[model samples]
Target: MNTISVQEADFDVGAEIEALSAGRCDVGAVASFVGLVRADTLAGGGDEVSAMTLEHYPGMTEKSLEAIVAEADGRWRLLGTRVIHRFGRLVPGERIVFVGVASSHRGDAFAACEFIMDYLKTRAPFWKKEDTPAGGRWVDAREADDSAAARWAK
Candidate 1:
């Protein structure tokens, strides 16, 4: 079974991988990715983003992530997958995203990890609000994210 979680609490990447691989013999490769809150925006906004608040549509968000994982499962010979995205206020050093994929081969595992992240950036319902020195502002979605997701289109 695949697992997807959106929580305000932090998670341990090593523990998550151990849990997923435990008692599973078929899994040969596990590829994972973790996203962190960067200090600066891509647009070169001089104002340093001190904090970021992530918002999600709850039920819809989980469903969307599940669908993305399902697609990865179908495209590759995946044994398991896990995605944990955090919400609420996050500082620069905090982890914002996690994607893990287990497969029989490294290629599949690598592709699945990248695929999940790409889909999550564009397909997921999570939005960000940045707290800058000037004030707070809602972050707009980037076109590059859309283009990344577009690569997976059939």
Candidate 2:
């Protein structure tokens, strides 16, 4: 089964991975990534960020994420995938996102997990606003993120 969620609450990394790989004998490898909020380097030209609030159009966001997962599944020999992204006000050092992939081999799991992350960075319909000492400012898309996602294009 493939699980996709866009929630406001933080998630447990281990439990999510276990949910993805549980009772699956064919799954020989599980690859995962967890993204966290950092105060040191935030968007909007801030050296210190107090908190970041993520916003998304609920239904549209989930559909976009599902499409990303589907594309990766089609390209790789994956057993299952789970993607969970958090929205709302989040402080530094808080868990932001999780991407996990289960496959029969190390290569497929790693590639698919990375591919999913790369796509999610660019394709997901989530906007961020950072609360810095200077005040609140909306975060813009970074060119570096675009460059990373572009490599996967056909």
Tell me how candidate 2 scores on lDDT. Answer: 0.92
List TM-scores for all candidates, in order.
0.94, 0.94
Against the true structure, candidate 2 reaches a TM-score of 0.94
- After superposing candidate 2 on the true structure, give the runs of residues whose Cα lies further than 4 Å from its correct spot: 41-47
- Give the CA lDDT, 0 to 100, for residue 151 in model 2: 89
- Write one digit per residue (lDDT tens) for candidate 2, span 1-154: 7899999998999998898778769889999999999786545564698999999988989999999999999999999999999999999999999999999999999999999999999999999999888788899899999988998888
lDDT: worst 10-residue window of model 2: 38-47
Q: Stretches of candidate 1 above 4 Å error?
A: 41-46
User: In angstroms, how far off is 125's CA in candidate 2?
Assistant: 0.5
The clash number for model 2 is 0
lDDT (10s digit) by residue, model 1, range 1-154:
7999999999999988877678989988989999998777646567898999999999999999999999998999999998999999999989999998888889999998999999999989999999998889899899999999899888
